[model samples]
Target: MTVICEECGKVYHVDPDKLDRYKGKNVRVRCGECGHVTQMSRLMDAAEEPAYDFEKAAAPSMPSAAPPQREMPEEPAPRPDIAYRTAGTEGRAGWLGLRGKMVILFLVIPILLLAISGYLSQQLLRQMATDITDESTELVLQEGKEKLMQKARDVAKQCEVYLQNHPTLEREDFFYDPEFSMLAVQVVGESGYTCLIQQPEPERGQNWTIWAHPNPNIIGIDDIDMIRKALGPHFEDFFKVLGASEGMRESDGNYMWKDPDGKIREKYMAVAPINLEGLPFLLMSTAYIDEFTAKTEYLKEYANNKTAEIRNINVGVLLIVIIIIGLCILIYGYRLTRSIQYLTEAADRISVGDLEAEIDIKSKDEIGNLADAISRMQDSLRFSIERLRRRR
Candidate 1:
């Protein structure tokens, strides 16, 4: 026969033959687990009815040999249902519980999102700063190129007018005349100048030559090899722009040039034709592009530094925010779950007939309302239990 303790739900197995002695009498057995008394006479009547052939076979052949006493077995194994309930309770003892899940949901997940957002924001700031710097540099370079070209055209026109006024001025005596040399050659920017150079005419056996220049040694040069030796690998790019001045049209480009100290630097060149009947000379204005873009470079560097500084500040602020959020969740969740734990323990006590369990929650939140309701229910249960006891 199987008997269960009502208060604690601990199951016990009773020998059917031992129960036959108290079959029709008011006998009771005390549960060893909880000491709750269970009347065996009611179970004995049910045990007498055979619901299956197996029970009838297991029963004692003679009822006169039954024991005179009814008692619980010394050791009883819990049923499968009891074991399953215990295992279920143990499963919730780890991080799968409510508090662990709340940390993951409100703290861990939010911090991950904040980190991702901060990374993307920093990347966007860097890209925007780079784009602005590139655009500003381009605008400054374009304006510089236009201004340099205009200066070359104006100087070329002035030289043509001066040469036409002096019709008898010979090519060999051009640089010797101070007034004509000053009109033909002039300074451009820092380490830059305008000079007169005629295009190569193989039909006349005259190579590309510089007629008037600031440097006296460079003037009247028709040797291509000497020019190539001076310019190095950048000779082709320089002449390419200079050659584009054919048909009396204007042309301009950039090329790397070797300075007197053998250092290489990027220089811009603008060519404008000097239309003096027989002279087919061109005025070339050349200057280092860095001269006009220095302020732009500085601004770009400033913008990049500012962007990095702002990104660092944002990262610090993000870390602070994550820390603050984590602290709030920890403190708030601890208090919230602590209150819940108290209510749960009180409910457990009430379920076990310990109506004296106190709910000390004082907050006027939903938890407080729930505590009040449970307190009322506990009072009603105590009152009903008291009334039943009085009647008994």
Candidate 2:
């Protein structure tokens, strides 16, 4: 397309694509030939012209017949190389830029850190509970063992008195006394008793006999075989108590046994000697380790509740901190991005020959400095352009 500049009257070729922007309107542009400013108007001719195929018009209706001449397609109009571009406009809204991406990362990092912190805190709380559980169990076991030893000694003294009061009674008859049998049966824990065992009677060709037992069903039964089978790992410990009671007034020993509740735990046996003239019997008490710390379940429940509370509070606080930090970063980033948007639009207008476009923002940052520099550059460009026109 050819257009004559109104100012310079210089005829120049202008691609129709550039004039497409001025459809039904006038736009001013500097003439490439003489720097003369000219106003050009173009109408897009929107009257909806019907498209015609030139090949069809020239081909004629020929079926399976060779055509004499080939028609060539018309050449397309050349597009303009000069396009009006606003600086930063093409990339502003659709995708995240470097500045926006950095801001997003800054906000997200804190949330991840807080999540890790919350997990670590919960583990610490559970570990502390386990420690407290172990420590309290040990303390109660020690105290219970001491009390059990003292109780055995008291029962030994009562046995000595019972022997002395029944002076005429045979040792065998006294051990099976109905009053003593009732006392032994009433006692609990570890399924044991403070009773007598007699060595083998050579006169009857019999092995050692259980003179008495807390369980009446085992009374007058053979002691050795039954004791070993019933006691399991405790069989040796029982014999140790039987032999050691002759010398030591009191002693303590350990064995493994299942409790009435069906849990296997350590059982401590306390043995004390009853000093009877000719017949010696050992007074014994067996107590399970768990019996000492009966409050363990309560303690554990309380600890769990308290740990849950602390974990809840810790999580709540961490979430609050993360939210506050994220909000602050988001708000700060939004303000910074808004200021940059203003500078971008101003720069965009300047790039398209709108030198009078005001940056309009006053700030004490690098962005503000850049705005001042661009304004100066605009003035410089206008001055240089005017000087060139005057020289021309």
| lDDT top scorer | 1
Q: For each candidate, what is the lDDT? A: 0.76, 0.64
Q: Model 1 segments beyond 4 Å from truth?
A: 1-96
Clashing pairs in 1: none
**Global fold similarity of model 1 (TM-score):** 0.74
Model 2 residue pairs with clashes: none
Question: What is the TM-score (0 to 1) of candidate 2?
Answer: 0.66
| Range of the 10 consecutive residues with the lowest summed lDDT in candidate 1 | 79-88
Candidate 2: where is the Cα deviation over 4 Å?
Answer: 1-18, 21-80, 86-105, 161-166, 175-214, 230-251, 258-266, 358-373, 376-380, 383-392
